[model samples]
Each structure stands twice: as structure tokens, then as C-alpha cells.
Target: MASESPEMNRLHPFSAVTTTLNRGIVGLSVPFFLIGVLSSVTDAVDPVWSIYLAPIGLVAGVAYGLTYYYRFEYALTQDTFDLSSGVFSRRSREIPFRRIQNVDVRQGLVQQLLGVAVVTIETAGGGDTEAQLNFVSEDEANRLQREIRRLTAAANGERSATEAETASSDEDEDEEATSNETADLETAATPERHSDPGVSEDERHEQPVDHGEPTRLFELSSRELGLYSFTSFSFAAVGGVLFLLLFANDAIFGLLISMAEPLGGPANLDSASPLEYGVFGIISLVNGLALTYLFSVVYTFLGYYGFQVGRAGEDLVYERGLLQRYSGSIPLEKVQSLTVSDNPLQRQIGYAGLWIETAGYGPDSGGGSQSAIPLARKRRVYGFAERLSGLERPSFRRPTTVARRRYLGRYSIIAGVVVAGAFGLSLVTAVENWWLAAVVFLAVPPAAHLRWVNLGYYVGEDNLVIRSGFWKRRTTVVPYYRLQTVSTRRSIFQRRLGLASLVVDTASSRTFFWATPTIYDLEYEVAREINETTRQRLQSALRERARSSDSEDGDAGVSVAFT
Candidate 1:
């Protein structure tokens, strides 16, 4: 066990009380639920005994909380953040400053009431939070965030200086051995340096002057939030409500019928005409959908209330949420890709959202990809993406006509199956308008054509752009150096159609549930060629970046020596 020093800090004393309450609620729930079940099933467990479980659990929780509070200690060392925790078994962890990617502060309702917050530290290549302080003074949390950022910046600066010195030493030795040859090499490289198209805007402006003040990039207004909520309707919310209704249908219908009887409503649905049934079903569905939409609107409002994003030195900082506040920073150096996304409705309205993916951050750590701008105009989003990624908007190449044929065949088969099913049902039932379902066939051609038109890929000088998805179109921009793996995959159906998908994997690509950055339904040969070309370009980009860094380091060293 490590002895406590002046540098070591413990959580706020009130953490014991909050921890007790949190644990007590959880501990009491299980026993009370079990007691209720046992009392209903048998006479062995009395319902009155459930009342005693609360105090017992509370006492146990208080004891555990006290122990845990005493056992936990943390300290900030020069190069690492050290933690000592565990009540029953001792465990210690040291997280290096270089590995830390983000330091986020979050406060739930209970914590807010208590005037404390949870501080989570995310590290490189980890799916979950590397370390968390459950309950700390809000001031302490802020201080910790600032301290981590300062330390990380200082560490990185020192590393860069050391590398520059080393590179300068190596260059000096090379010049001494071949001074004439080095002079000739420099002459040959001068023109190539000026005309290198592979050099990115970021490389040109490697380090921007920092004023120590955050630059606000975007903010969400109430009107725009509402518009975004309504346009980005979540079918998942509707499905959840439907799922709940399925299991509680009997009780829900009985209550509804009882309420209707008071108003002298229809006594039996069985005696209604087919037309009446259709009207009733439509009314119910419309009502359900309206309720679902309202729920989604409220959910979105709560989640994104007072949302804002800004650039703070080398980090992108964001703060959001109404009830559970979240404030976090994303290290710009770790960013892997940027995505501009919009639904068909939003696209028509000229609005979109921007999302950023960073290494070691995902759904398990609060959210999959952080939203740089939750809602904005399409042009504003594109401009922001280009500025952050250092790449211009790309001109996309549409898939070949063969890919369009595949989509047509696919949607047509789906329409055929649905129409056939409806016709078969009409033969067995008294319904007369089953042929109306054939109208689905009328949509197949347009739907297939729209899907093809929306799918495209562009290989830029320093980045790869992929645009896909019909319902929620996303234009993903992945820089060449950020690309982890590039491959061509052919599904069984795609193989039959002689088509393949080019998949570009990055550090954060696998974190989301949707497909990675992919160009789907391309010619097999074309996909293979793209795959190989992307790999070669990735290698070249890395080499170019390395040379650029070395040249910068040498220049710095020369200036310092001259001074």
C-alpha cells in the first residue's frame, strides 16, 4: 500500500453519503423485488420483512462506502497520473500523460444536487474509460482537467524538442561525411519541396498561434434543435413503445374500452365493417406515431440542450445536456475522421450535422462519435469539416451502371414478394383491394435509382471520401495517414453480381454499429485496384509526413544554433 503524501488527494467527504445512497438503492431493489415475488408465490416470506431490508442494505452500503472512500487515493505525478483503489483487494494504476486522449467531466442530477461531478479519463486504444473519479468537488474536477491538458502539452513539447536535437545531430554527422553531396541533394530537393502536392494545409501550418482563449465554432439554438429533432425522427423510439404495448395490450385495451363505454362508444370491434376497421387501425397508428415523435422530441431536447463546441488550443471542446451535463475535450492530434451527415429531409432543407471520430473513444465511453455540430446548414458543415480535416470538398465518382442494375433487381424482387403475399392473402380473405399493394412496384425503379445516385467515392490527394446511405447519408473524410487497413470484400450476393465493397478501416471505424467507411457495389476489379492504390498512397503519405517533420526539425535546430 502506498502511503498518503501531500500530493495525494481523496474524493470529497460527501462522496460517502452519495455512494451509500446509490449502492443502497441498488441493494434494496433486488431483495424487495424477490420478497414481493416470494410473498405472492408462497407463504414463507412475509411482505413486512421487505421493509426491514432497506435499513439493512443501507447499513451495509454505508460501511462499504466508507471503506471504499478510505481506500481510494490519486495523485498527479510529473509524467503520469497515479491511482490507488479497491476496498477488499489493493490495486494501483499509472496512466502516462502521453497516452491520455480525453478528460471529461460529467454530472448527473444527483451529483449536481450534491455539487460534485465525475471525472473520466480516456486513454489511447481503449474502448472504455481508463479511470474515473466517481465523486469529486466540481472545482477539483475542473482543476484536474486543466492540469492534465497542461501536463500533456508540456510533455509533447519536450518530446518534440528532443527529437529535433537528435535529428540535428544526425544531419550534422551526414554533412561532415559528404558536405558536397549534401549541398547537391539540397539543391535537387528545393524545387520538389515547393511543388509537393501531397503536403496538406495542416503540414504547412503545423502549429497555429494559441491565444489561450477558446474559439467558439458552433452553437445550437432552440429553433434549430426542434427542427433537427422533428426531421431526424428516431424509429427506435417508436419500436420501443410498440414493444411495451405488445406485452401490456390486454390491460391497455381494457382500460381504453372502459373509458370509451362512458362516452357510449362502440361496444364491439368484431361487428365493425372492414372499412371501419381500416379507419380505426389508421387512427391508432397515427396516434402511436404522434406519441413516438413527441417522445423523441423531448428526448433530443434534454440530451442536447445548450449544446456548444469550441476550439481550445489543440483540443476541440464540447459541452451539452440539460439534466446530465457533459463537458469534454477531444485531442485534435488523435482525430481519425470527420463525417457530415443528414437525412433526406434535412438534405432537402439544406441542413446537416458534423461528427468527429477519435481514437479510443466510442459508444462505451458515453457516445460513439462526438458531434462537432449537432445541426447546421450544409455549407457551414462542409466548411467546418474542410477546415478541421485540411482537405477540400471532393468530387465524388458514381458507381457503374452495373451497380444500378443490381439495386433495381434487388428492389424489384422485394416488391414482387410483397405483392405476391398480398395477392395470396386476398384469395384466402374477404378483402377486395389487395391489388392496391401492387403500387409498391411503382416505387422500385425510383428508389433503386436514388440509391445508386446517392452512393459515390472520391480519392483525393491526401484523403479518401465516401458517400453512402439513403435514409441518413454520410460523407466520411478519412485522411491517408489515418487509414489503418484497406481491403476489398465480396459478399455472396455481391459476388454473383460481380461487385465488391472497398472498406477503409480506421482506429475508430469499428466503434459504430453502422457500416464502416465503404464504397459499396463497385466493380470487383475496380475495388481491388482502389484497395491497392489506397495502400500505396498511405505508405507514400506517411513517408512524406516523416520527411516534412525531419525538415522542420532541422530548420529549428539550425535557427537555435545560429542564435
Candidate 2:
């Protein structure tokens, strides 16, 4: 591969055209669209002038693309990958092999057309500290990522061997030097002697598991995608329709009226009979809904058309997409938490999705949590979560049945406030119907009861499990050592009820709601007990890891999850 070439290499020359075209189209699309709208609505400029702008933009884009192609250069070494790129002020970055956390290969519409892919390198340091080689051949992109993985593994193995050798030499020297010391002193020093100062905590804990070859975990079938299209929420479709209405309402309505003119369309609602207006409204709504649903199905299907997930060595690999394929791998050890989600409707049909939360690559990463299983049965969800988490089926300690009253009370207060306001307004205006408010009040009790039943917390042998959400249920499993903060909160209502909420915070931010995974409506005493136990677990896990690092045997006290 050219990436493996000893000399610094530039991207495929054709990248210049692709990059320029992609950026220019996206950057100038809005302005050009506005110009078109203005030209149609008002004769601001001759139609021929608009045609000239396109060629000018294309020429400028080509020039910029050529400059970028010449300026970009990258080199892959045994220990580091260096990248240099800048049009005016040159900037260079060196990403050490050891710090690389993830490698992703993406082929967008433009890259696909150009027969190239973009390779993104993300490091453990997080944030915008990432490098991208935007125009490598698809094969080279994959090969480059594999090459980096191989080099990183080799470097880690070499480091481990060196540490083991150093530890052995130190043990021998300690045995010789302590020969004259008392037996008790020698025994104490023996334990401390095995602790190699050369090994970092992460290295000591990273004991390789014997998974053998890459194992296929799950793949989304066409049937499954069809099921997901119906079960999965597609809010984007609604947003698209709203965007069309907001930006091109006049053009869209005009087109619709023109199409319906032969059928006695009510273009002027004021001149139409009541029945005609009603028929027109119904047609428009049905058309909008049908369009929205179709758009949603197509968009969702295209995004996850050929999803495949597997375990490759110590990493979890995910590859999906139809028109623009995306491939990424996450080290198993970087997974901070595992989650399973299913809405009430989905749960009824025995469908749920499994997701993993990794450090840095959280909700802001665009895709939210990385999906392990896009769509699966409930049993598969538990099985995959267990395999990924190295934990048996997750179960809660207790359902907050006792807190049903608290939930009902809080919800009743909210419902009452709405009902009272509506009742007051109804006295002055008939449109603010008191009966409508009463109908909403009727649903509050059931909603509160459902929430109470779903809220629970479990203190497992190796993990802390939190379950909540009734309509869209979510179960979060996080290791004790991964916990960054554990706290108890008391709302005024909960405080009055002698109850507190236990919140478990982990390094994974994808567990979004940023409200954290909380166990709500617990007795104050029980909450305190759980909090204390969680803290002890964290300390114990940390100590065990420390002991593992100090042991001469590689597997002495290794955490099962990391292994």
C-alpha cells in the first residue's frame, strides 16, 4: 500500500476535485437556492447571470482543491503517524500509535463517486485532536487502519515483554539482596518487589483474552431493517416536511394547487363551501403524512441497509450504510457502559437495540452511542449486552412500588395546575374547554404508575445497573471502577416523602439526558446504603487493579471486563 511506503505520501490527486466539489456545493447551496427563489419571485437579475456564477464558483473551487492537494502530506512510521496540511500557514501533527483510540473509514457521496474513502484517526486525548486522510482508496483506507492496529498491538506486546523481563530481574536482585534480612522483612519486600515501575496501570490491566479469530456477533437483515423502519422513531421525516413548509411554502402550495385544479381544488378557501374546505384539508394532511412516512422509510433504510457488527481481536467492529459505507472499530476496554433501549411498542413486539458508550465518542459524535445490535429480539439484546459487558442478565434490586404515591403525587400536582388553568380560561373563553383538561388529568395517574414500576436500581457483583423510562425503557450497565461520581439528590417532593434519588455517573456521556442514570424514589436510608456500597465497590475495584499491576503473573488480578 502507498500508505506503507517509506516516503511521505500525498492523497490521491483526484481528491482535490472531490473535496472542492463537495465543499463548494454544500457551502454555496443555500445562497444559490435563495438566488433562484429571488429570481423567480422578482426580476432582480437576468437568468443568464445566474448561469455564469456556477462556472465562476467551479473555477475557484478547482483552484482551492488543487492547492489543498499539493499541500497535504502524511507518513506512517512504526510508532507514530504524522500529517501535514495547510494552504497558507503549514500545520503538522504527530499521532503516536499508542494513543490512538479509534480508526474509522467513511465513504460519503463525493468520496464514493471518486472511488476513495476518508480515514479518521481519533486519540485517547479526545476533543478535536483527531487527524483525517480525506482521499485514500477504499482498500488503502482499510489496509491503513489494519496496519495501525497491527503496529499498536506489536508495540503493546513488546512493552509487556520488556516489563515482564524487568520484573523478573528485579525479583532476582531482591531475592539476593534480602538474603540477610529477617524472614518477615523479606516476605513484605517480596510482594512490593514484583510491582514493576515500568508498566503503566492501563498496560498492566490490559490482559489479552483468547477470542481467537474475529467472531460475527450480529448483522441487520433486510427483514430486520423493515421491522426497524416501523418500530424505530423517525422524527427527521417530520422535520423535513416542516423545513419544506418554512422555506418553500409558496412554491409547494402553488404546485399542489396547480395539480388539483382540474379536480375543483379549493385554492381560495374563503370562496369554497365548508365541505370543499374540509375535503381539501383532509387531502393535504394525508398527502403530507404519506410523504413524511415514505421519506422516513427510505432515509432510515439507506442509513442502515447492510449493518454488520463483529468482534475483531480485542475490538468491536461495526460496518453499515448503503450509498455511503462507514466502518469503525472500538476497543472493548474503551467501552464505559452498555445500554439496551426499547419503547413500549417495540418491547411489546420483542424488539430492542443494544448500544455502547465509549469515552470521548459520546452523543456529540453525531451517531450518539455506537450501536452493537441495531435491531434484535429481547433475548438477543440481553445476550449481546451480557457478552459485551461480561455480566450475566442485568436485574434490579427492587422496583419502587413504595414510591408509587410519590410519583402520583408529583404528577397530580402538574396535572392539577394545567387543569386549573384550563378551567379558569374556560370561564372566559369556550375554546379553552375544561373537559379537555380533565382528559389530560385522567392520563396522569397511569403514566405516573408506569414510571414507578419501571424505576429501579441494582448493585451487581461487578456492575451497577439502573433501569428507568416507561414509554421508552432504558437499562444502563456500568462497571464500578468506571464510575466518576455517585451522588444522592432530594427534590422537595421526595424530601417530603422521606425519599432520595441515587444518580450513578460514568465516563460515558452518551448515556444522555445528561441527567445521568438515576434510581429514583428510594427511601433515604436505602439510598444512603446503596451510595456507600457503590463507593466501597469503586475502591475495591481500584485496589484490585493496583494489586493486579503489582503481581508478577499477568492474570493475577486482572479485571474480567478489560481482559
In terms of TM-score, the best-performing candidate is 1
Please, what is the TM-score per model? 0.80, 0.78
- The lDDT of model 2 is 0.70
Positional deviation of 236 in candidate 1, in angstroms? Answer: 6.0
C-alpha-based local distance difference test score of model 1? 0.74
lDDT of 1 at 151: 71
The per-residue C-alpha lDDT of model 1 at residue 454 equals 93
lDDT of 2 by residue, 1-563 (tens): 24554688788767776777775675445446656877888887555565667666656665666777888988888778888898878898888887777788888887788788888887655555388887798878877877776666555545544654554454334333222222222233333323534222442333223233344556787778888877776678898888887886667877665555456667664587766676677777777888888878887787788998865554677888888888887776677888788888788888898878776643223423677877877776775576455465566765456688877777888988998898888888855447677777688889888888777677887788888888678888888878999999998878887888988887665533434778887899999998999999889888776655445333332234352
Residue-wise lDDT of candidate 1 within 237-276, one digit each (tens)? 7776777688866676565444444444344566755555
